[model samples]
Target: TVLYYDDEMLLELKSVVISNCAVGHGGRVIIPTEIKEGKLIIAVLQGEVTVLNTLGERAAKNNMVA
Candidate 1:
């Protein structure tokens, strides 16, 4: 799952594996890394997020400014 700090929401990315990234929010950003062909689930509780993948990097937010 890819997260954007400015968007203030969690994204359930699909058909991709996530690795070597950091999750800053209170909840979890579930990526399809294990299955390799499954749906990604992003559960946000609080704070912002910055998701980094092989293609590029992005950020997400929840009330607080990044």
Candidate 2:
């Protein structure tokens, strides 16, 4: 769920496959262009990250030589 601070609402994208995630400049979560075309940005403030597999782990796995 992506939170919009402007309206204080949560937007959820269902059945969307996340192709890739990486650490962007200033430690932001960089969503690949193929996924959302740099449209949405989800920010996590004042709370713990609770995703099944984090972006860091996914980025590491993607960078690994298979």
Candidate 3:
């Protein structure tokens, strides 16, 4: 599910693997370091997102909103 602006879906990501998806405002995500086996797992229900693995560092760090 995806919404641009208040469209709906709000934002949902559960055990979802991603190679793309760069939204803003919340549920952040960034892992474009030339894509070294890049991977951005998601499990948020509210806000916060800043995971960067694949040897890039920043294993996981989100506000965590169940």
Candidate 4:
């Protein structure tokens, strides 16, 4: 499954895969969903984004958009 917006993207995957790239210009944040199963991994394939912490505060900023 896949979900996308101007500022967020998420995928529900249980295996490896590759997809085409369609860039969305005009800077926006990207929040990839957290997967509690299978020792969660994250990769920054392109662009920039802002991440928030558990306390609703700024965590990290930039480059985690895929």
Candidate with top lDDT is 2
In the range 1-66, model 2's lDDT, one tens digit per residue, is 332222232233222334335767898666555554434545533333344643356666677868
Task: Give the alpha-carbon lDDT of every model.
Answer: 0.37, 0.44, 0.35, 0.32
Tell me each candidate's TM-score.
0.21, 0.29, 0.18, 0.18
Best TM-score goes to which candidate?
2
Candidate 3 pairs with clashing backbones:
none
The candidate 3 region of ten consecutive residues with least summed lDDT is 1-10
Rank by TM-score (best first): 2, 1, 4, 3
Worst lDDT 10-window in candidate 1: 1-10
- Model 1 clashes, total count: 6
Q: Write the per-residue lDDT of candidate 4 for residues 1-66, one digit (tens) a residue.
A: 222222222232122222443335754223333422333334433434344232212222233434
Higher-lDDT candidate of 3 and 4: 3
Q: What is the lDDT of residue 38 in candidate 1?
A: 38
lDDT of 4: 0.32
Clashing pairs in 2: none
Candidate 3 has a TM-score of 0.18
